[model samples]
Target: MDLDAYVAAHAFEWQRLEALTKKRRLTGAEADELVERYQQVATHLSVVRTSAPDPSLVAHLSSLLSRARNRAAGGRTGTWRGVQLFFTDRFPAALYRLRWWWITTLVVNVVVTGVMIWWLLDHPLVEQSLLSPAEVDQLVNHDFEDYYSEYAASHFAAQVWVNNAWVAALCLALGILGFPIVYLLFTNMANVAILGSIMIRHDHGAHFWGLLLPHGLLELTAVFVAAGVGLKLFWSWVEPGELTRSQSIAREGRTAGTVALGLVAVLFVSGVIEAFVTPSGLPTWARVGIGILAEAVFFAYVFVLGRQAFHRGQTGDVDASLLEDRVATQA
Candidate 1:
């Protein structure tokens, strides 16, 4: 395709475009010249990409064209449309892409939690080590039920919201560390297991389920999803496949950040339920029904809307315009 010669022929025009774009001030004629050269270079880049696929040449021309277009057009302002697009496309697609990771975490943690509960119940020594007979009696009889009603609903909701959000944020922010994600998730399972064991041991298992199922369904799912995303981020760089390690990390990091933001809303829902419904005197079945309903809606949001977004090729990553397409890389 004689790519070198083609580039050489248009080299002066390209140089002029670059110079005009770089200038802090430009004459009217120079501005017009920048637009004209930008168009010509766009055509050149297209020909180079089709006839001679050189990553270096294509990247260089792309960068020049991008700069020229920006100078010719000017900056775009943010709008409500950006927020709309985020929810409609990016956020859902990102979750759908990582569905398997989150689902696996959900299953594994649930199984581990059950096993821990059984282990604690079967071994008197384990339960004894955790809490003395008197303490266990108090926890199962009073503390477990009283914990929810201990604080006013409004105050409790805020506290739960912040605490759950912080835990989710920690899972997401420390996901790159790999082991931290595992540790964080394990700690969550242990807490649930300890409580479940104490309740079952005291023959208040129904009471435990009645209280836990309401908010626990959605709340725990949100936490699981956060931890899954974090572990996925760690795996991204560990096994990036075709992408360079840096590119893999950057892409996953951006997507993970979006997920963390999305979880804030999910956790908010869980928090509201925990404060109002969990502690409220709504019948146990009704509270569990509402929790299950909320959990169902979340899954539907991810599976239905998220699947649509993913199939349409939206990955919840930032707009292509925002990513530096000119990052030098070998083809």
Candidate 2:
């Protein structure tokens, strides 16, 4: 393939790309020249990859191309348009791409919650071990029902949103450790299970489902999504596919951040449902129906808009200009 001869022929152009990459400030003409040489060197890298395929040369050109791509795209900008693009495109697309992770998380949580409920129901000892007879009675009768009305609707809604948002955030922040996510999910599911068991044991099974399903569907789903995305982020470092571990973690972590932010909106909706609809005078059917409708819309958003964005090559990562120029560790 005459690798050395080919390298010599185009060495000047490659050198120019390197020079432009390292230059702190570039003139307009030099900027144009940088782009030109970048493209030419990209072709050169392609030729070398196909003709000679030297590991060292390929890595060098790969890093150079990455830097050039970022430079040509320009650096990051903080503007309203960029903010608008992020929500409309990047956020949903990330959710769509990692839809499976969250969905699996939801399913597992539901199953775990159900199992906990079943175990408690079958074994009265477990329920009694967790709560006293009077305490359980109070929860099933007054405490559970009064919990909604005791707080002002607005305050309750805000509190619910904040609390659930915190849980989601914890999942993201601690997801890298793996154990924290599992512990958080287990603890959450167990609490719900205990409450459901208490209600059902006292012959208020219908009431339990009625209140829980009204907002619990979407609310729980958001939490699951958070945990799922967090787990995926951890897995990115565990098994990064073609990318280096650092590169994979960086990409997935950014995407996970998007999910964390998007989930705030989602949890807010669920909080509204829990505060207003669950305890309102609305008929059971209507209340549960609203919850179902909200959940459906979320699924549709992820599947429809998210799918389209993903197919168009959206990866939920920040724009290229906002990312590393050469997968280099930089601030």
Candidate 3:
């Protein structure tokens, strides 16, 4: 076919192929095959039945094809598409994978929480040291009823959500330093333990669960996910696997960072629920149900949508020099 006709005939298929490739992982052989096919198609298009093509024909074709493929692969159109790509495609795909981290963190947190609870139960003075006199007095007098009411009245849901979202973002960002993630996880666990101890001491543990589970589940999960992504980065540095430390770090950074942004979104939504819906005196069963439902939705997004969205492409240009260097260096 002539260059123009070939371009016109194959453009749509190429775009679809590009999107599919971006959204799904492919083996090295498959990637090589696809790249070869793409080059052949473009070469044929460049040579036949045309007056000399534009000098920048390959570059122009690649750019146009990339944009079309991006749009086809869930990218938005227009100026804001760049922003959306940053957040949705780039950010979320990098950072969010919490199951391993959550499991590890839950064990640590639970152990720490148990120790703290035991200490507080054994030495009441620990409570005095942790809780102010006024706070203790209020707890003893069952004045938490009024305190909670006042606390609930004062904080607007929107502000709480924004604040929590900011915290999650900060955790992910700071975690690049490595140690900050451990600190953040430890601090969060302390908070949960402290709160649990106070409630258990006051014989209001059930109420506390009702109030917290509604939002705490999702909020805590997000936090753990962020920490996990950070740990992944740290491990890449320490272990390096088959990749050089730098390459591994970069790859981990991209995937873990994107997933972290998604966690921030989860935290934002959870915070809103915690501030508003969770504290509204719902029944224990109702709170648990909501928490379970939210968790289900979060997992669905992470596993199903995440896999579909961030998988590596089957076709793309490979740097010949880089491959040659790796082969030579390894040999």
Candidate 4:
């Protein structure tokens, strides 16, 4: 049959099938017939429309076919139970697809750290330029010993951490509007420059490890990750690849959001250390150990847990703790 005639002949059947599928009440025979008819109609429509069938339509048809097959094998079961199972199985998969932001953020962090390290090593004068005279005086006196102590005890640590978190969130959120991401990047770079300067000017560039290797590790890494997400969202608008800018932005936004949440968690931990540990005159070795442990944990969470969460959905391996006895036995 010609495409038009086939569409005309089956139009009412297709409409009825779609309606029944929406109601989730098709009988086995009726679903089977509808599936067969949908396949034929879809093939004909493809020729006429010169495009693939809509994915939603294909999903609906496949679902109806599955429902029919299930009914044939076993009389019936509650639809709500099936839906619950579907969501339980699929939520991880959804989360997995949304992990690109975390990965991207991690990469950005590494790059930023590398850049900061190189700048501190290569350009001492610029580092000197970055710090204020009072900061420079503290560095000369080795008085930063007390500065970290004050920071740990003061309310300022909490305020600083909160402000940083808000700024990071704003960067991610503003990228949605397209222009704010540029400003976000510039602001972040300035902050990095100031931090790098502090490390270099203090202790005659000798205390870099003491100053930054501790709390700076997680805190700076979080900042870089947040910046990376912002950059990705901004780039989505400027270079959207094959998709429309809006579509690309939306896709990247989901990943960026997850990464931002992870950053917030990092900031919370880092802030506590900065407020209480760094400033409290902890032994240098102790501070180093704490920083190293925190970084290790953060790394594992981002690279290991993050990857598993991303790919877990595709493997259909539910966490053992969440599975009931029947589900476990069936598996």
lDDT of each: 0.87, 0.85, 0.60, 0.59
Per-residue alpha-carbon lDDT of candidate 1 for residues 21-58, written as tens digits (9 for 90 to 100): 89987788887787678767777777777789899988
- Candidate that would win on TM-score: 1
Using lDDT as the measure, the top candidate is 1
Q: How does candidate 2 score on lDDT? A: 0.85
Model 3, range 241-269, lDDT digits (tens) per residue?
99998887776666565565556567777
RMSD of each: 6.4, 6.9, 9.6, 10.8
Give the higher-TM-score candidate: 3 or 4: 3
Ranking, lDDT, top scorer first:
1, 2, 3, 4
Candidate 2 lDDT by residue in tens digits, 1-331: 8888887888888888988888877788988888678767767777777778999999988888888777766522345766676767788899999989989999988998899899899999888788888898788888887887789999999999999999999999887877899999999999899889889988999888888898999998999989999899889888999999998998888998988888898999999999999999998899889989999999998888888889999979877644533332211
TM-score of each: 0.78, 0.76, 0.63, 0.54
Q: How big is the positional error of residue 202 in model 2, measured in Å on the Cα after superposition?
A: 1.0
Candidate 4: which stretches are off by over 4 Å?
1-135, 142-147, 151-154, 176-202, 239-244, 314-331
Candidate 3 regions exceeding 4 Å error are 1-98, 139-155, 303-331
lDDT of 3 at 301: 62
Deviation (Å) of 254 in candidate 1: 0.5
Off by over 4 Å in 2: 1-80, 327-331
